[model samples]
Target: MYFEKIDSLNDLKKLSIEQLKILADEMREVLLLKLSSHGGHIGPNLGTVELIIAMHYVFNSPIDQFVFDVSHQSYVHKMLTGRKQSFLEARHYDDVSGFTNPDESEHDLFCIGHTSTSISLACGLMKARDLRQEKNNIVAVIGDGSLSGGEAYEGMNNVVEVGTNMIVIVNDNEMSIAENHGGIYQNLKLLRDSKGKAECNFFEALGFEYFYIENGHDMNELVTTLKKVKDVEHPVVVHVHTIKGKGFKFAEENKEMYHAGPPFDRKSGKYIYPLDNPESYPAVTAAFLMEQIKKNPKVAVLNSGTPGGFGMNAEWRKEAGSQYIDVGIAEEHAVAMASGMAKNGVVPVLNVYSTFLQRAYDQLSQDLCINENPAVILVYLASVYGMNDKTHVGIFDIVMLGNMPNIVYLAPTCVEEHFAMLKWAMTQREHPVAIRVPAKEFISSGKEDTTDYNKLNKFAVTRHGRDVAIIALGDFYTIGRDVADKLKAECNMDVTLINPKFISGLDTALLDSLKKDHKLVVTLEDGVLEGGFGQKIASYYGTSDMKVKNYGIKNSFPDRYNVEELLIENGITVEKIAEDMEKIIG
Candidate 1:
C-alpha cells in the first residue's frame, strides 16, 4: 500500500502523480476504516485529501509551515505527516485529537478548532520568520464555510501588509456545518463561475494575486498550481473548488449529517451509534421554539450558523421560514442583528454555543445589554458537560457574561424550570435575558414553577437545615443535592440545599438570613471558580462571619477531559466536598 510506504514527506515526494493518486486512495481507505469504527469529521477530511497531498508534495513542511483553518480538515495532513497509523488502526484511535495539536506533531503549526483565523495566524508566523531572517512559505488552508466570519476579512486585510511568501488556500466546498449562508458565498460563486477571470474579485480587492482551480480533486492541477505560488514574493490566494464529501457516498449525499457524527456501518454507510435520549435538550429546545414561532409573528429564532448545537433541525428551520435566521458563523453579527430586531418591537431569541458566543462579548455588552433590548440569548452547552477542547470549552460563560451590566443571566436546574424561564424571558420587555441551559437532561420538579422572575435575584431554598448551606448553580444543583444527601447519610448532618437560579445577581436578603443559622456557605458552580459564580459569593461574604468555600474547576485550559474524573481532580465531587466539610464543620 502506498499509505504504508508513506513514512514521511520524503517518501511522499518520491511518488509520481500516478503513485500519489494511488496514495490518495489508500489515505481515504484509512480514513473510512477509522471513522466507520470511531466517527469523526468525515466530509472535511475526505474533500481535502488530494489538496493536502499536493501541498505535502510541493512544499517542504515543518520548514514551509501550513496552518489549517479549523483543523477539522487536518486529518489528511496528519496522515501524511508520519501519523498514518492513528488513522489506519482502530487501536490507535485515541492517539490523536479530532483537531490539530502541536503536541501530537511538529507538522501541525497550531492547535486550532475555531474557524476563520488561519490567514491572520499565518501572518504572525510569517512576521516571526522575517524577524529570524529565515525564508520559508507560510500557508493557511481555509474552507469556504469559514469565510462567513468577519475575522477572515480582517485577516485578509492584514495579509497585504506582510510583503512576503504567504499562500492562502480557499477550499470551496459550498458547505459549513450547515449549508453556506451570507453574501460572500455569492461572490465566491461569481469567482467560481468565471473560473479565475472574474471582475470585482474579493481576493483581488484585498490586494492579493488570485488564482483559481476548477477541479480541486485533480492531483496534477493542484500540484502545478501550488508550485506556481510556492516561492511568490507577495501574498496570494489559491481558490480551489472541491467537493466536501468527496470519496464516501453517504457523506457526499448528506453533507450536513456527515460533517461530524458517531461511528457508522462501513458497508451500508449507516450510523452505528444512535441517539440514546430523544428528549435531549436540543430536541426539546427545537420542539419548544417551533411551537412558539407559530403563536407569534415577531418571535424569531436566530442561530450563529450552528443549528445542530441548538437543536434547530431542517424541518424546524424550514417551518420558521424568514422567522429563522442562520447568520452564518458570525456570532457578533448575529448578536447585533438580534438587538436591532428587539429594538423594533420584535422578540428575537439568539441561540449560540457558549464558546462561540464569546466572540460577541462586545456586541452583547455595547449593543444588546446597554440598550436593554429585551432579547433572549440561549447559551447552549455552557457547563462542564460541554466539549473539553481548550478552544471550545463552554465553562467560561459565567466569567465572561455574568458580570455584564443590565443582562439577566438565569440558570435553570430542571427541564420544567428551563421551560418556565424561557416562557418568562419571551414575554419580558424590560431587560435582556440569557438562559444558561442545563448541559444534561434533568429530572423535573413535578411541581409547576409559578415564581415571578421579574422580581430578580431570588434564591430558591429546596431544603432547610443547619450549620452548612450549599448553594448550587445551574446543572451543579443536582450535585449539591447529592452532596447534601451524602452528608446526611454519612455524617448525620442536615445541611441546607439552595438552587441559585440567578447567576447574574446574588440574593442578598437570603444570604444575610443564612448568616443567622449557617456557619459555612458552600458555593457550587459548573465552571471555573476564579472569575465565576462561586467567586462572586466569596466576594459577597468577604467581611461576614460565614466562611465561604467555593467548589468548581480551576482557571486553566483542560483538553479532552473525562467529566467525572475532572470533577474528582477539582475537589468537586460529593465525597470529596463532604469529606472537606466534615473536617471543617465536624
Candidate 2:
C-alpha cells in the first residue's frame, strides 16, 4: 500500500503521479475507516485529501508553513506529516488532536480550532520570515465559510501591506458547517459560476492576485496552480472549488449531518450511537423556537454558521424562513446584529455555543449590555460536560458573560426552569438576558417554573436545613443535591440546598440569611472557579464570619478529559464534597 510505504512527506515525494493517485484512494480509505470508527470531521477531511496532497507535493512543509483555519480539516495534513499512525491504527486514533496542533508535528504551524484566523496567523509568519531574512512560502488554508468573519476581512485588508509571499487557499465547498450565508457567499457563488473568469473578484479588490481552480479535485491542476505561486513575491488567493463530502455518497448528499459526527456504520452510513433522544436540549429548543416563531413575527433566531449545533436544521430553518438567520461563522456580527434587532422592536434570540460566544465579548459588553438591548442570548454547552477540547471548552463563559453589567445571566437546573427563563427573557425589555443552557442530561422538575425572573438575583431555597448550605448553579445543582443527600445519610447532617439561578448578580438578602444559620457555605458551579459564579459568592463572605468553599473546575485549559475524573480532581464529587464539608463544619 502507498500509505504503508510512506512514513513522512519525504516518502510521499518519492511516489510517481500514478502512485500518488493510488495513494489518494488509499488515504481516503484510511480516513473513512478511522472517522467511521473514531468520529470526527468526515466531510471536511474527505474533501481536502487531494488539495492537501497537491500542496504537500508542491511545497516542503515544516519549512513552508501551513496554517489551517479552524483546523478541523487538517486530518489529511496530519496523515501527510509524521502522524499517520494516529489514523492508521484504531488504538492510536486519539494520539493526535482533531485540529492542527503544533506539538503533534513540525508541519502544523498553529493550534487553531476557532474560525477565520489562518490569514492573520499566516501574515504574522510572513512578517517574521521577512524580518529573519527567510525565503519560505507561508500558506493559509481557509474555508469559504470562514471568509464571512470580520477578522478574515481585517486579515485580507492588512496582508497586502506586507508585500511578501503569502498564499491563501480558499476551500470553497459552498458550506460553513451548515450552508454558507452572508453577502460574500454571493460573490463566491458568482466566482464559481464564472469559473475564474469573473471581473468582480473579492480577493483582487483587496489588492491580492487571485487564481481560481474550477476542479479542485484534479491533482494535476492543483499541483500546477500551486507551483506557480510557490515563491510568488505578492499576496495571492488560490480559490479552489471542491466537493465538501467528496468520497462518501451519504456525506455528499447530507453535508451538514456528516460535517462532524459520532462513530457510524460505514456500509449503511448510519450513526452507531444515534442521538434519538426527543428530550435533548437541541430537540427541545427547536420545538420551543418553532412555537414562538408561529406566535410572534418579531421573534427571530440567529446562529453563526453552526445551525445544527443549536438544533436549527434544514427543515427548521426553512420553516422559520425569515425568522431564522445563519450569520455564517461571524460571531461578532451575530452579537452586534442581535443588538440592532433588539434596539428596534424585534426580540432576537441568538443561540451560540459558549466557546464561540467568547469571540464576541466586545459586542456583548459594548453593543448588547452597554446599550441594554433586551436580546435573548442562549449560551449552549456552558459546562464541564460541554466541549472537552481546550480551544472549544465552554467553562469560561461564566466568567466571560456573568461578570458583565446590564446582562442578566440565568442558569437553569432543569427543563422547566430553562423554559421559564426563556419565556421571561423573550418578553422582558428591562435588560439584556443570557441563559446558560444546561449541557447535561435532560432533567424535569415535572412542574412548570413560576419564578418571576423579573425579580432578578432571587435565590431559590429548594431545601430548608441548618449548619451547612450548598448553593449550586445550573448543571452543578444536581451535584450539590447529591452532596446534600450524602451529608444527610453518611454524616447525619441536615444540609440546606439553594439554587442560585442568576449568575451575573447575587441575592444579597438570601446570602445574608444563609450566614445566620449556616456555618460553611459551599458554592458549586460547572465552570472555572476563578472569576466565576462560585468566586463571586466566596468574595461576598470573605470578610464575614461565614466560611465559603467553592467547588469548580480550576483555571486550566483541559483537553479531552474524563468528566468524572476531572470533577473528582477538583474535589467536586459527592463523597469528597461531603467529607470536606463535614471537616469544615467541625
Candidate 3:
C-alpha cells in the first residue's frame, strides 16, 4: 500500500526507512504476481528492489539520469516511476516492454536491452550535461556479469576523461545469463573478499574513486552510500554486493533458470505454460556437438556467456570438459577465438544469439570472413519470431552476415537440414560458414538432407509446377509449402516451390531456369525485406521479364509483437500468398 503513494521519485522523499522497506515488500509482491502470471526477467527485478528504492530516495530523476545495463533490472524503477500498474496488475502486463524504452517513460534515458553499454551511455549524458553547463548527477548501474564485456571496460577507460559529476554503480550479483566467466570475474571476487580494502582494485586502477557496500539490500546503507556520492565532483564506482535472486527462495537456489522465465505458479514456482515441443535447434546442435567433440579431438563447441540457453547445460559442458569454451559475455572475443581455432586446423562451432552476434560484426567480417576461416558459427534465433525488442531483434542478422564476403550463410528449414548443415560447416575448410538456426519450434522433415553444400548457391526444388515459382528461404519453407498446396487445391494450378537454403548468395542458374515456365517469381524470407534473402532475388530479377515479389518483415523494430499477427501483416500467410498467385495467374 506504501507503493500506492509512490507516483514519482519525490514521493520517496516523504517515506521513512521503515516505510521504504515496507514499500519494497509491496513492490516485490506486485512483481511476483505479474511475473508469475506473465513471463519476465524475475530475478533481476526482485534483487534490485532495494537498490532502486534507494536510488529514488537519493537521486533526482529526469535531472539525475540513470542508465541501467541490460535494463532487465529496471522493473523496480519502472514501478516507482508512474508505471506501477504494469507490474501490479495482470491486464496491464502487456502495456510496457521487458526492457527500458525512452518511448515508455521520460525517466528512461535510452531504449536498452543488450548488456554492458551503461557506462558509455552515461558518459555521453555527462558530456552533454557538461556542454549545457548544468550541474546534475549521472549514474550508470551495471552488473558484475556485464563487466566481462569489452565495451564495459572501454566505457570505464573513457569515463575517467570526463572529470566531472558521474557515478558508476556496480551491482555485483555474481552472475550473467549464466555463471560469470573470464579473469575479470576473479578480480571482482577478490575485491568482494577484501571488503573494498584490496591493493589491486580494477575500478581504482581505471581512475575511479571506489566505494563498496557489503549489504546492498539494506535501504539505509544503500541510500547513505548513494547520498555520499550524489554530488561528487568526479567519477566514482559504488560497488554494491547484492544477491541476484535476493527475496525469492526458488530464484536464490537456481539463479540461472530464474534470471528470465515464462509464466509460472506463484506458490510452487512451476511453469504455468508447458513447452509443446521441447526438441529445439539448440538442443539438437548441442547433442551433435557433444558427439563430435567426443569422437574428434579437433572439434570444439564455443559460446559467449550463455551456454545453457544455447543448450550446452552443465552436464553437457562437463562432458565437453576441455573442448567446450565460454568466453563470458564477449561475443567479439568468441568470434576471434573461433577464427583462430579454425586457422590451426581445429573446427570451432561458435553458437550465439543473432542479436548478440551484432556486437561482433567487425570480427565476423575482418577476422573470420576476410580470412575465409572454416569456423562454424551457429546463429540462433535469426527470425522475426525471436526475442522481440528494439535492442534484441534477431531479424537483422541476415542483412549483417549476408553482406560479408567469403562468409557462407545458410538457413535451415528443419532439424535434419540444420544438423546436416552443421556437420558440413564443421568439417569443411572452404569458407567461414554461419547457419541461421530457426527460432520456430524444431520439426523433422523425415527426409535425410544429403545435398552437397560444396555446390554452393544451389536451391532444392521440393515440388515442380507451372505458371508461378515460389522460392522460400530457411524458416519460411513451411509457409511456402502451404501456399503451394493451396494453389493446387483452390486455383487448380501447381506451383514450383524452391527451398533456397543458402542466404549468402542466390542460385542464379536455377533462378534463370525458372523464367521458362514461371511467369511470376515469389520469394519468402523470415527477416527484414531490405538487405535480406528476398531482396537479393528481387535485385536479380529487377530488369527481367519475370515479375518478382518479395515477402518479408519490414525494416522496423517491433516490440513484443504477436507472431501470427506479424506474419499476417507482412502478407506471409498461405491465404495471402495464394490470393496473390491467383491474381498473378489471372
Best-performing candidate as measured by lDDT: 2
What TM-score would you give candidate 3 relative to the actual structure? 0.98
Model 2, global lDDT: 0.91
User: Of the candidates shown, which would achieve the greatest TM-score relative to the real structure?
Assistant: 2
Rank by TM-score, highest first: 2, 3, 1
Per-residue accuracy of model 2 over 331-434 as CA lDDT, tens digit each? 99999999999999999999999999999999999999999999999999998999898888999999988899999999999999999999999999989999
Separately for all candidates shown, the number of backbone clashes (residues 3 or more apart, or on different chains) is: 0, 0, 0
| Preferred candidate (lDDT higher): 2 or 3 | 2
Per-residue lDDT of 489 in model 3: 84
After superposing candidate 2, which stretches have Cα over 4 Å from the reference?
none
Could you tell me which residue pairs clash in candidate 1?
A: none
TM-score, each model? 0.98, 0.99, 0.98
Badly placed stretches (over 4 Å) of model 1 are 275-277
RMSD values for the candidates in order, in angstroms, are: 1.3, 0.9, 1.3
Candidate 3 clashes between residue pairs 3 or more apart in a chain or in different chains: none
